[model samples]
Target: MSSNNTSQIAAASALGRLSPVANAPSLESIVAAATQLVPLLREQGQQTEINRRLSEEMSRRFEEAGFYRLMQPARYGGYEYGFTAMMDLISEIGRGCASSAWAAALGVIHNWLLALFPEQAQDDVWGPTPNALMCGSYAPVTMAEPTEGGWLIQGKWKFASNVDNSQWAVLGVQFPPAEKGAPPGAGFVVVPRREWTIEDDWFVAGQAGTGSKTVVIGKPSFVPAHRRLLFPEAASGKAPGTAVNTNPVYTIPFLAAMPVCLASPLLGAAQGAIDVFVDMCGSRVTRGGAGGGGNRLSGFSHVQSRLAGAAAAVDAARLVLDRDTSEVEHTVSAGNAISVDKRIRNRRGHAYSAKLCHGAIQDLFTTVGASGLTLDQPIQRIWRDGNMIAQHITLNWDAVSTMAGQQMLGLEPKGAY
Candidate 1:
């Protein structure tokens, strides 16, 4: 067998030996190592803000650790590893630095998403460098027209995450018919950064370091037709990735996967809070005598109970997500339709995971005392970032619940995705 094939066999053998029901790495070890690296991230957090993006040093560390390659096809520079491990890894990063994790999460997942594009689009993005990073905004931010070989593209796509560093982007648009608004059909049009300029638009009260700017593409540029994609297929239960990837994990619904990827960073940020709170609570000596028994916060029955509940929520939410991914993977792998019931379950589970982590983080913030209120505090950043990101529709638990409930009751729910 070839050397590459040998490596795959060896890795698969090792994974088999582990016999993890999830078929992934030891989540704890990954979390521990990533947690240890958080302080280093925290030290450079201000620098990231000043640079208006993640520091090259931080990005290099992530790349060196093979973090960016998590979602890449193994034939390229990637592990093609378990989706669970990817979630564990991103959560750790989020705990330390939400924006870095958010940016990295977006950039990394884009690699996987590329596998869903047409081979020509894949060539346009990854043909250059397997490690080539791409970022994008999907909310139809411009006008695109049917033309020979490509679309005549114009307009600025906003919320383009990690744009300052990305080599390419997937700017989605709805191509209107020659007639005024004949049914709307969506397509993701690929554009190289060289053909577009990034506007400084990501300044905000939270996730400030994401550098989620806008891509301003005008008269000077357009993406070819081969680099574009149809939407109804993805919205229903299809994606081009199956033809190229042959990986069951990539077979999951396109819109479904977006929220799953996003909630991960938020969970990681909360876990980061938990890690710190545990440390801080362990070392404290309150007026009540080492908070009594020298166990610090652990000695306080109420604190212990809260921690227990929060930890339970975190674990519970993770289990739901794990179950959802597995089901999605299994069904799609077999060429089955992902039922509306399952999709609703997936959405509800995703929103709950985000909410669970949000509640846990909020509880920790309240319990961490005045130290967290300072601008220099790590918990403060985590608290702000988590709260802000949880507001995203993906984590809006009420909406997910409402939709799921309506669907179960044989009622139609409204929304594009």
Candidate 2:
């Protein structure tokens, strides 16, 4: 049987509401589920790469464990746990396999974004299947024309991670042209899986299993107003569903808040690299036995220092994510909107954290020597994953640092920063 079919069967077999009633799974239970899945994810890491996406089994297991529902609304049977808990989950999963972690993180975060849409949109997705997965691309590429029902949308959205695993998609589009004085508007439109086609074009050297393919809308389709959420409304935390889904976690800004999910996995990947490197060090011996004796590679001060630095870098990355997420949470809990400065700081922190992850992977990879370059070596995969993550637009150091610098100078920060 095809992998997709097998995965569907697996997920269906394991399918049951994590929270059939109001009470959701305990944090400990949810975390344990993620922790336990690590070995399986690691075992499937190679297959995930070969398949160019996550396995059906892993996705189903995440559903059974309620990992995808961490930030979902309780009213819809989601756990609604805070972002910190989800980050912790993602980091733990990342240590096992970065690709799986990436797919899991993106697939889960899309649900949180859906929470910000109108109640009708939320119901349309979760009403039938609360366990239904959502995936998306933030780039506004669709063209919209004003129509009787709402707007007719057409175009393609790229880099939709884990698109195959999802039942719905939240796509970006430019609204129909506005009046002369009014600025052109951009927004997100909720479309069911049947409304769009997945372009199986996700080919990359790293994070290949994310299945971040292009989603195409061939003919125009009507999207009602209830399914549309403008960028401005989302960024200001004044979403349509705010009245119903009143959790403080939903109050976080969309642009500034979501990047944390992206960076979380990289930290885990770097840590995973460190773990494998340390293991390799313990067993690997240098040529000539390092002074004609049975000297372990780890016995060298050089290897020890590199390992120590990598660990410290990974630790620092975790701290940055924790601090930034906590501050955002505090702001929301205090009934205050996240300020522009604070949002800028989040961008800085996310980018810096990614930088630290990249450095950590590089530190360990460089010292591991030729064997580390082999395809079967786990650290090689980790190193590639880390490098690719650093390339993500949200985590690009130069661009984010520039934005932070602009904010510091009393000039308005540019772009998403």
Full-model lDDT, candidate 2:
0.84
The TM-scores of all predictions, comma-separated, are 0.86, 0.92
For model 2, residues 197-236, the per-residue Cα lDDT tens digits are 9999999999998999999889988888789999887887
Give the alpha carbon lDDT tens digit for every residue of 78-104 in model 1: 555445556777777876788888888
Off by over 4 Å in 1: 1-36, 178-181, 286-299
lDDT of 1: 0.73
TM-score of 1: 0.86
Whole-model Cα lDDT of every candidate shown, in order? 0.73, 0.84
